[model samples]
Target: MSPLASLTTILTFISVVCAATSWTTTPFNPAAIPLAVRSPYLSAWLAQGAGNALNDVWPTFWTGAIVGWAGFINVDGESYVFLGDPDVPNASFQKAVQKSFEFTSTQSVFVLSAGPVDLTATFLSPVEPSDLANQSFPFSYLALSAASNDGQPHAVQVYTDISAEWVSGDDSLTVNWTTTVGDTITHQVQLEDQTVFGEVNDRIQQGSAFHSTLNSTGTTFQTGQDVVVRAQFIQNGVLANTQDTDFRAVSDDWPVFALAHDLGTISAASDPVIFSIGHVRDPAVEYLIANDATQNRSLFFWSQISTLDDAITTFLQDFPNALARADAFDAQVNADASQISSNYAGLVALSIRQGFGAIEITLSKDASGQFNTSDIMAFLKEISSDGNVNTVDVIFPTWPLLLYTNPAIGKYLLIPLFAYQATGQYPNAWAVHDMGASYPKALGHNDGNDEPMPLEESGNMVIMTLSHFQRTGDNSIITTYFDLLDQWTQFLITDALIPENQISTDDFAGSLANQTNLAIKGIVGIKAMAEIASIVGDTARSSNYSSISASYVPQWQQFATSSDGKHLTLSYGNDSSWGLSYNMFADVLLNTSVFPASVYDMQTAWYETVVNEFGVPLDTRHTYTKSDWQSWTAALVTSTTVRDIFINSVFKYAADEENSQPLGDWYETLNGDVEGFKARPVVGGHLALLALQAVRTQTAMPAV
Candidate 1:
């Protein structure tokens, strides 16, 4: 048996039982646990490693910047820290012993022992792919429940706070905050001087951070310095319900918004205390349309709800239903993915939140300054890598998850790219690289000075467009973009067969001429255009593309295949070189038999021989590999053994103890170390296996 198989078997019998603390971590332990990741700015995580228990480490943004979120509980008048490390000087509070940690698609649950009482802290970020209102909301839920562990009743009070670090990434920035007492207690924190659409280290500098909980008899609110407020709760079990008048820099004294729930006496059952944490930014994105003008776009939730208070209250009230929906969604993903392998299921579960976290669904405003609900658009920030907006290559990798969850989301993501180019603002003959250089500002590159990935992006657009059409059966996208699509196809015909020394999607590996994988992508793209043409009743163009793609395949196989006939070359003439042909996944997904099955078999067999401890390398160039492309390549294999080899490798990397960052798509294959990227939406491609399975299970193909 393989190492992964042995590890899986060992994990079945592994459970740590001790007198002080009994621990049970199910499935596997991730490098970092996602705490409350909603949108790009609302993301938070807890790094997992030595001395990194829940109480020992602070929650961090995706960029690894500390976001002060702390939680403490008073058991029988004795304070214990359960959530974050506040590093209070000479504090008397003891740390809770974490008993278990488990994560699903939408929640990260941790059970900790605070004295004789056991606390379950659940961080839930709902993934409602079909519900635009809920999905667009930036808030995430934190539900805490306590029960007696030794059959003895104990008095408990739960305290949690959000520090001013959340308002801005820069520590020196001055922050001001307010506390409102209404149906719910809310503490709103923001920068004293807001810079709209500005970002510091990938954290928004203009948004207001709201920390709220429902107003109840036993609940009290407070806002003060982090050390002072937490020290108050540590000594006394309740806050003073006081607000600090002094507003200063985030790091000066470290201001915090706090709420405490006093459970008089806990026996067998205690009511759960729920809190909502989020960031609200008006005019979420600066979008460009066909008129060569830029307009501010508000988040889609704003159109559904008028005020921030309403959005928070509705979210807090809907916790039970939201939890149920998230549980169902998690079960469905696990059930579907386990059909292949448990490792694949774990990967799918981890990918869901990180995948959805990179996008924002926004509605454009009308002439009257009200959000136009009908004029909805979605934009994605290519996190960790240049922060490009609506990057074509980036979207290509991420579409599998969107397509699997809701096909309409895939259409929404494509609209911005299409709308920007249709205005004749882009000067390139092929597709544009991305909508903007920076996120939230999707100003089209009218100067046509965007990065040139002409062949890579053009093929990616055609393939993704056809895949979306196949799933949705909405030919309107094809009919509307036919002229541009035809133009891209023409560019493919001239440059695909002998690809110039231009970079592929793996631009980090540098440029190459006649890449075997690039050639296959272009060929499949041509075939995809044929399908698109046929859908629109353009038979002449369809036939032309079909014949061109068919003619190029034989030549591609001849030039790209190695002399040993074992694997494909990295470039056309370098027979000694080999690379992953992940582009073959499009052919499998679209069912476009452009390449023969023998090619799949050959590549599958060859991959097993070159596999490392983590997974197969991207190419002969480096030992590092992209998890997304690995999954895409895994979907191409015909054998279950080879497919599991790929799946298990990526799962091992995710569970690597040394890796403390959010799920990174690029990592070293030998030691399972992160190569460059982190918290990227491209991890959505990890669902390639399930996406292909969904495609195969369709009873009938949509008619054009």
Candidate 2:
């Protein structure tokens, strides 16, 4: 053969090997990593399943009908399933909790409960059963089955709020029921021929679908009034209800309480149920109940979970039984259906989608029995802790709107550590840009406001520094990043004094300098930076920041307040009304360490005057506003009602209510149209849920 022919044969062989290798490589395999120095492929493949499909990936379950999330693990005689935002560390922790149409997992013990009444647990899933023997379970691959609890053949029937129809593990039990929207379903699991709790004394009806019986072991009986339950784990080998393991929460809010270990004299009429939810995951946990009581018919929550934004709960709790919850379940579900029907309706019909929230990251348990990260979930390990992304700009500082209130804070919230990660120059610190593009590739700060925005960015840096310190309870970030903090503090101190030459991101209109609201920006920046000093044990620096900021607060008030003062001038001493957002950006969220609560309330009242249909305008002329900035300051109102209004306004802006498009960050209020800035990504700032959650949990909901 000629030399040319030989070369061609060699090239063809090489091509075949490459193809074969590609075909052999399974994306889900966690071990298949690139070279040591190479960047990670996608954010996550297991948690997300090649979640790098471009346009923000939606979780599998919400995508269509049956998207699976993290699988429930049957651990040492008990089973556990992560409710929302699978810790991404597990291979089974996908966006959707259900991967297969029908899920079946064979195990030993069985447990399931409804609000207060406890019963034999089995088959917790999205789809309801048509019959007791479960002719079919929704989705495929996944299953929850317990062969025999202890020695006897234990059996129980299951039902959901979706429909009264029942499915049973015991061949004889069956229920025929029907329901409509807004209706609730009551499920009972009891021993055969045993009467207990509220139900009338009846020999356990031979074919009774519901059952419950009281046993002496604290929570061994069926009862009402208790909205949550717990599991009892036997250490090593002690069996037969040794002790209560861990309890879950009906509500994952702060300061969750559980019953005492010792049972006092029990009045059969009083406390019937002993089990309680000992833990609760906040912020993210709200998604489990939403505002809907129906959706929560048989809901369960991961306990003791904290959020990046604890504010939303605090905000909502302000109106616990307020009208905010009226038709809440039905309305919300309808809204979701409307939104999905608009655009995302057909998405899952084609293929698997990711879960809700972030694609990477999961909180699971390791072999050590301690809750740790998952091996399969280690998809982005390269970029996770210490990857070489050149830079780490957290663009999606916020995430998953209603679900994730305090979301990411730019993946690495608090520190705003971008340029440091990018240039490998953690000099003073880094400039966090909401988040690094999407994830992992933190190089671009495509926020569009580059070369501009001093107040917004500067103040953010200081507060972020302080918050990070509080969270890690570590002073390293603040201590090392102090010099940079001073630079911003100094900049705010010297330059922002008059608000000249310093335009913040009150992007409703354009950028302006020395604006009245902006003065708060400077004050807050200085105060927050000083907070960093205090966190690092530098009382001197903290005092200095506080004292100086204190002096400026009233001065700014005197200077910015107008004569017939329902509102203040946007610019100091001038009638030129500009963005009122500076009120929120400065005095409210950030300067809390300095100004009195009244100041924020007053400022919020002033700020209220500027709100348009979309939100408070960036200025006097533009009918449009930036939802990012709107949510930013609007959320500072301290009043949950106001915050809810602002939050609702944001939903009004989002396609969730009607028009379905990628979250429109900028829009015109007059006609509710997308004015400009379509899918730029900085809108993640709107996710302040975690941040709000943090504030609420950390501080008392100030007496608004």
Best by TM-score: 1
Measured by lDDT, the strongest candidate is: 1
Runs in model 2 with CA error above 4 Å?
1-450, 506-508, 576-578, 582-593, 606-611, 638-641, 655-658, 678-690, 698-704
Candidate 1 ranges beyond 4 A from true positions: 1-22, 699-704
Q: List RMSD in Å for every model shown.
A: 3.0, 23.4
Whole-model lDDT, model 1: 0.87
Worst 10 residues of 1 by lDDT: 12-21
lDDT of 1 by residue, 279-349 (tens): 99997999887778888988899888878989999999999989989988888889888989876888889
Show pairs that collide, candidate 1: none
Per-residue error for 208 in candidate 2, Å, reads 54
Clash count of each predicted structure: 0, 89
Native-to-model Cα distance after best TM-score fit, residue 581 in candidate 1, in Å: 0.3
Give model 1 RMSD, 1 decimal.
Answer: 3.0
